[model samples]
Target: MTTFDKYPTVIVSENEKDVWEGSKHIVKQLKTVALDHNLIAIECYPGIDVKKLYHDVIQPLNADETIYAADLFYNNHTITEMIESNLTEDDVFGTFSPHSLEEFLDDKKVKAVKEKLKSNQKKNIIIYGMGASLFSNESLLIYVDIARWEIQQRLQRGMPNWRTNNQDEQISRKMKRSYFFEWPLADRLKKALLNQVDFWIDGNDIENLKLISKEKYLQGLSQVVSQPFRLVPFFAPGVWGGEWMREKFDLDKDEVNFAWSFNGVPAENSIHLQYGDCKIEIPANNVVFYYPTELLGNKVYGRFGREFPIRFNFLDTIKGQNLSLQVHPTTEYAHEEFGAHYTQDESYYILHAEEDAIVYLGLKENIENEEMIKELEEAEVGNKDFDDEKFINRMRIKKHDHYSIPGGTIHSQGKNSVVLEISSTPNIYTFKLWDWGRVDLDGKPRPIHLHHGLESIQWTRDENWVKEHLSSPNQLIAEGEGWYEEKTGLHELEFIETRRHWFSTIVYHETHDSVNVLNLVEGEEAIVESINGEFEPFVVHYAETFIIPEHIKEYSIRPHGPSEGKTIATIKAFVRV
Candidate 1:
């Protein structure tokens, strides 16, 4: 079993000061700040508990008057109609919305709230909740933030979305609504207000809140991108989940199985900042929002503004079942239907596999598209089973084998293998065509999107095409005394380039004006150091994902401690430019 550090943290500073812990200290700070500024605005993200925050902080301060920003929103019926186009009748998919937060608020109510705040100047007034910052520019603003992973957890635990009461809705539907509508609206406002906020609060943990000044928060983000760092990885159980992550990573044994380890997707992960001995958790996307040019070089930022284009994650099916038969939308289809700039072009690198492991990829030669669609439709309605062997090609897989899967290619990962999935940032556009007549862990049939899948499938990509372009040939590109680098397959059609390095001595690397993401695929431990000693040496273990920012021009890696004098390997991915 390998020892994986699940909760990795970055030490922002050695000095032990400037962190407020617990509700009492936070309330005290708010009260002191309210003495000078009467209009205190606490702007919150969607998943935050406004009631809990009011009870804990505002109630203690005993403000003479309070205004809730949520009260200014239009009625639930009008708001629903406004976003109905984005939230389609389908349960699993929705179009992305380009609306702002102000669109949801009632104009008359907002004007009334402004008047109330102005009239209560002598009464020590406070305004709190989502869109609270829009009331006044001079008010003392506190932005409350939470990670997307935390928001998903809350939704699973029966928490409702902001301005709507749908706590009993299905988890997948709620997530779709948030992804296509709620999150985009909130993120736009956050990006505009983050630079000028007075204070920032980490509300991931309700009982233990952390407060800090905006200067300290931005400084912590700056320290993070200057060197190599890891995000806090989170694990989730799925219907086809496996036992590999549970056994090897020392995850919870009580759970049925662990399927995914979201290691490098910044939007769904979080970063830890240690001030002295106190650690504060904040959304990882904040780094991308604040330092786009510094974190993702000029070239990458120009292509995808304020977004992390590359993603690294793990899909463990070892000793488990096969993944659903699925296909992703093409770039044009994704842009026209979902308002996404780019589609999900991905590749799978086999980390570990059993002897009988296999992967279903592409279609067999001389297959009819109408015949395959007919069988899938029949299987969807339980009329008959879809005979996958009659139409698809199944390729046996082994350790270190790489397979490139661009958008519109039909694919599925078979059982008894651990796959490192490297892909673009739009992670939720999968169109599952078939599910083998199986139900989810909740005893409900998983939604199938046969219509969407049929529209996106590339019928010309048959077995011959996959054999020529998708599978890795492991072509040797460069060699040194003790190290050699090989080009791994990510296909020319994909925007990400992948390279694997096998080394016993130090191997040098340069970002070349683009951010790089890497994994220590083979080795007990390795050490990464800056060529010019610009930052401290960072150590990584087997199967751990880490990032090197664009600012770090050059670096080197070698086996360390237990793996000294032994050969190790790393697989790295970056933008094609």
Candidate 2:
């Protein structure tokens, strides 16, 4: 029998009510099984005496927990020796201080961690009980990209003995530097403790995140808002722009702006061509002046791009029209052909859809690959027939049904479909497959680029194509575990998956790991607690997402809101294995 199947680790708890009850229980259940190797944690009140229970046998688990553990994996003996003396001794620091997670600038202690959680305004949770686990003693941990850089700097100065695990296992050197170079600087308090010497984290990165459009920002205001409007109780006109102009954009701009108004354009307003809802006005030019050019560069395209925890396209269906059946290029696809930094792999979580609304997935079964090829190749002329649509197969899809679209997959939305299109932040690259043979008053076939679409198509097809998975059948609210792993879609070029939990959960990790993009799927009332306070117990609304860095572990979350509140969804996107 395998170690886990044989010697299951055991979890013990003293303060049963310590909010992380689910995680606490799982830890206990692990002990009964036979496991040769694994990390384990156990806590019971301030001093319950685990020695008496496990004293009969030598605990073989890799992890152990107590009231006074200073690195159980590296320093368990210290905790054991102290426990023999007294329960009220130095052990308290090991069991209660939040410092065990990270050294806080305020105070690297458990009580401080608790205080931060209690006062956290983001709407996280309170950790009343202590929980610990020694799991994953054997894990390959690699810090990559910016997060990796920060860890490197800290390790270089703070601890001298630290060294690389395997110098040769390098992450792809070409992720095309992300705006992580623009992450907000750590608070003044944290800066003091980290003491990153001469750590010039630049001053202008903030500009990239500044909200730069008001007219374009209000693209969908007509729906959630009323006409002949007053921006008071009806709709509190949200300032559409970033708050950290220089820090977000790293543009070094003093301020950012995105305010514009439009009536009509004189066809020749500017040099660049204008499309639906986009143009430079004239006569009544009435520039909704987004003042700063740094802000203007992005505003020119309106708020179609964003950064941070994530960047996505927010579609407001004030005017609904079937976007040409199209496919997006994956990050890899972008890099291979056009070269893109942001990812194009995407999925649609229906925010709001008409009852009878429909969405087209891919070709239905029985359509031969050669037929698909022939259809695309011989499609200059058209008539009204299913065969005439030479694009995505139109089908009715409604609320709550998630549509997973990997790159190179032919798909599109039909009439009356408004969705939160969550995907990579590249904000560029969409290959148009086909558009209904309709044109604007100009009578032009909108626009077609089959060359680009062909490059984006995933040739491989499974018998069961267009699989729309239903989310939360029983609302299997995770009691407490590392994470719920779900593999959703597969692509010849890429694959997609999601790791989510309602209540905050503890996910143990080893040194080598992967950074996951986390998008909040539901329940605006939830908080994700972490070792350091970067992820405070805060509230998140629908369509929101976050990133979980690799290596950090033991963070837990609790649902807010009056109901049995918890994080609704933390969808993850990763390269397929």
Candidate 3:
């Protein structure tokens, strides 16, 4: 059948099983759909309790056994058939990595299941799992979406703590494993299947699960494609978590504290597409893949393909402790060592700060390479504290201050500060040099990457050099009756650039060849609208990051309040020539 002919079929697919609604509700939904046709519901799940699902869902729904259960179909081949054993680090880190579901397509066991779905001669068949929806043609697809944070909360509440017995240990283990180790691969598989879906359900909303249609979904995408878009922020806890974001943002009080918010790192965050009165959430990377040029423009598409090259996130340490001293690899080193396409060149934009706020940046002026290395080595192996002031320079900062951090620079956020980190898109690959002789909540010494830090640190970034170059000196670039723009000299190293705008009236701007990453750092709220009446206007609030797509050639921003004459300050970043 042609692609256009396949739009009518509706396939309900979930990224992961809902914590509240198990197979019982899903199977009941399937059975209700099966009443008028010869229907079969295939449960294509592994690493799960299939027998429990059968007793709980199938037996209750299937009175005459007309709705056949294909649960054991995956047993045709072992799990080993889906992945290569004893993979080396180099092999795993290489480019051209395929998602886990992509590997299943080649296995003969999957082929057998596909043939069974075809040969059953049923007018309607429901295949439900990771890749189950991919087997059929002319079917509408449904994706059930959930955030990684919500999944952890559900797991902690119900599931057995397999990794640890200690509460702190379990939380730490869950954060580390869930975010970096396990979910990345699983998310890759989910993203691979997202484009094929016709509807999406917010799995977190068990009471009134919003079912979004493909037409409405795509229509929402089109509206936001060339306009300012923001993703649903995902939060996580840290040992140095503070009360600022937890109280100011009104987050879940159950969390230890809100430490980080994944604002616009597309690979690690998802966007919510508004559909009439409902909303659908999909991986932010899907938008880049679906419309690369529209989101990233022609120049970016030609250079980076579908990769969104910038990330905006928050690091809150107000009334908390200092972050670990860390360094990221240079672009050349990242490509050669980890096979990464880009390096993380970051900057700290202090959104709010207490009286004693200070940032650890670069090394002391007279420190030699050997002394620094020896200090790091001693700290890593013996949990010994370095003479922080003798080696590391602590620069005092206040709200609205910007600190540049190119790759290879040693830096960390200090206590009593809430920083908006603007950087390149590379998320992982930090080499922690020290954690200030402190142990994690589990009473274990946190990891210190001595070797990698030694290799990546650019020793030239001394105290004087840092003050001269990394310190942002804002300069006025343009001004009008009630609006003005200032160029914030963040860095020119990674093709990423930033500017600040203070405007009381509507100020016009254009995205010439790059997408715009923006936040209302010093205002209550603001509205973004197209200059030529093309796309609809959108509102952004304080400390919230939003994007203006490359397709939005011209747009304007105005302060959003009681229409008085209060100035609004916004920070905007983008790729530059």
Q: Backbone clashes per model, in order?
A: 0, 76, 5
Tens digits of lDDT, candidate 2, 270-290: 111112322211110011121
Give candidate 3's total backbone clashes. Answer: 5
What is candidate 2's TM-score against the reference?
0.40
**What does candidate 3's lDDT look like per residue over 16-49, in tens digits?**
2321134455556645654654433332211122
CA-lDDT, candidates in order = 0.91, 0.33, 0.67
Q: Between the candidate structures 2 and 3, which one is better when assessed by TM-score?
A: 3
- C-alpha lDDT of candidate 2 relative to the true structure: 0.33
Worst 10 residues of 1 by lDDT: 13-22
lDDT of 1 by residue, 1-577 (tens): 6668898999987864666878899888878877888788899999998888888877888888888889999977888899999999989789988899988889899888778776777777778898899885688899989999999999999999878889999998899889998899889999999887888889999878888888888889999998899999999998888999888789998998988999999999999999887788988899999999889999999999999999999999988899999999989889988888999999999999999999989999999888999999999999998999999989999999999999999999999999999998899989998898999999999999998899999998899999998999799989999999999979888999899999999999978678999999998999999998899999999999999999897999999989999999999999987
Better of 1 and 2 by lDDT: 1
TM-score against truth, every candidate: 0.99, 0.40, 0.80
Candidate 1 has what TM-score?
0.99
Identify the runs in model 2 with alpha carbons over 4 angstroms from their true place: 1-311, 316-319, 329-336, 339-343, 368-391, 394-396, 425-427, 439-445, 459-463, 468-496, 504-512, 531-536, 548-554, 562-567, 574-577
Give the residue spans of candidate 1 off by over 4 A.
Answer: none
**Could you tell me which residue pairs clash in candidate 3?**
6-138, 9-139, 9-140, 10-140, 11-140
Worst 10 residues of 3 by lDDT: 1-10
